[model samples]
Target: MSERQQAEAGRVRLASALSASGALTSEWVEAYQAVPRDWFVPDLIWPGRADGVRQEESAHRLADPARWWEAVYSDIPLTTQWDDGEHTGNGRGTTPTSSNSMPTMVFSMLAALNPQDGHRVLEIGTGTGWNAALLSHQVGDGNVVTVEVDQESAAAAKYRLAQAKCAPRIVVGDGAKGCPDGAPFDRVIATCSVRRVPYEWVAQARPGAVIVVPWAPEYGGEAVVRLTVGEDGTASGRFVGSSAFMRLRRQRAERPNSLAYLSGPWPADGVRSTTTLSPEDVGGWLAMFAVGARVPDAFPLVERYADGSYTLWLHDTAVTSWSTVDWEPGRTSYEVVQSGPRSLWDEVAAAHYWWRDQGHPGFERFGLTVTPEGETVWLDSPAT
Candidate 1:
């Protein structure tokens, strides 16, 4: 089939899938169909898996048009820019800096925003301008204001928006600032994940405005949070669903090397322990979320071997504590070596038990309350 046919077919299939999944609602189905994700996506892309953070190599339109088209139509995210546009070539970069988010997630967040006919919207990230265009269509072009941290990405998205026959104000600035000139917007949306919901976003939004953003903790895991702005510079809401998006540049966490945590060789100045908790138990997205919620200032890194086995390295953001849990297939117990002032493995195991005790609550059960002071995550309700 022709490219046009493929694009149309993709849109139809995506719309159907989203509708079936209850993400692509009737209110925004036309906008999803109208704004072809491919129009905004770059020619060079790294298609991402739904459950995995790694990309499966790069697919260039010139070299592999069929694969490119297939990736664009699929309901998965496509990594467009890597390493803040530093490292180049066909290979995948160290980190995925920006991406055209998954269609389901894109529409789901939009659905959460639930903008009115003439409501003004502030978009934190304009990766490809597809989101801004969709917002422009739902509201008016003049009613949408998008901020992009990277100038190159902002300019490229601007061009794509113009090509799509829409002209939303695209600002080249930090997304956390939230376009003060467009203050008191009816709704605010962030395409990137944030460690903390910026106070500027809440301040810029009108009272009762809905703010949809992907929020991740320092430990690990991420989810889309839908917050309702309060009149008093605060926003509190429940997590609508799980998500994995590129971090907002300003809020990106510093990931020091795991070796930095060690003062000497393996097991040096360390304590050894064996636990029935298999390394496989603490893996997966939701499990990470549960552990991250309780364990602060630490994150996990996996070192894979030639075989399926690997070591899970837990490092504290302060660079003071470190722990390693070795996992082998069909193992009843795991070997753990922990060092430094903090017992990182103990904290993680405690978190896992806590989550299990809470009936293994999902993302929907968790909520966040963001104020000028800081953000607090709670299970079930903010009161908890």
Candidate 2:
């Protein structure tokens, strides 16, 4: 076995995955085993952890045994890039491009997709094409169609897919617009994170089929939602679970401070406005789901060395309008405003109220329906 193959993370991971997906369809499980994830990931990539990538430094994907093995095997997602555009993924900047999603989360999402043989599938945000290969194994290579917006990343992923012998028709287009030429798919899955369900997905699905995507909730976080399309193109289902995936390729995710409107005349009052958990958590969740619109897989706050505290700041894209909500205790206060166009907190607070009215319990109660025209999210009521 090649060094990368010998360091097989899937050997153990696949075992755990099989057990976790107890009721998984037999066909799905076999496909999972057939497609090795390492083949899809580059020999060198970043691990999603406490600065797993050397600061402003590059590391070989197979050079370090423990780091490589752990990063490939672990559930934490690795950072692929920063600054949205074609910035070299040399482990610097802000925009995250691609990642080998935590192994279990990948299983969780695929299990949720539940693809079957002959089921035509449409996949969005091909990323590293790992999920596409897995889907191809279950649905047949010819039945899978995957889309990616980044030309460079898409080209690299195309090469990787060839290496793995899994080539689903990869389209270089905006995933927001589902691959139309290959419409009427049996199942559709998105690897990157999403805020709103794309209308194109609704238009592309075969009736009674499933379209699985992640959506941010008003409750300050994101829930991976699975909606089964109706004969009429409407769909609905509950939040399958939580995951943190990147947004669709090149989609500029913005954060809206919806909570401040509830704070009223005083910022202190807003602090106690019912949804006040730690601002770090709330803001993180919002950025993941709403404004920042990142993946809901989740992140941790840890210090690696002396003065190595992680500071997650919520600010305007231009950095002119900025706010502070540090993870530390009582060290920072939020600036909230409700009545203006830029009032980000107010918008979030409104979303919270909307969700609470539907039943403040959790994401389990929420659902969505997408159509060729648009999409709708409702409680109890299925989309169609």
| Candidate with the greatest lDDT versus the true structure | 1
Residue pairs in candidate 1 whose N, alpha carbon or C atoms collide under 3 angstroms: none
lDDT by residue (tens digit), candidate 2, 158-214: 898888788789998899899989988989898877756877788788888888887
Q: Model 1 — TM-score against the truth? A: 0.95
Write one digit per residue (lDDT tens) for candidate 1, span 78-189. 8998798897778987888888988888888998999999999999999988999999999999999999999999999999999999999989998988899888799999
Segments in model 1 whose C-alpha atoms lie over 4 Å from true places: 52-54
lDDT of 1: 0.89
How do all models score by TM-score?
A: 0.95, 0.73
Alpha-carbon RMSD to native, per candidate: 1.7, 6.7
Please report, in order, the local distance difference test score of every candidate based on alpha carbons.
Answer: 0.89, 0.62
Model 1 alpha-carbon miss at residue 122, Å: 0.8
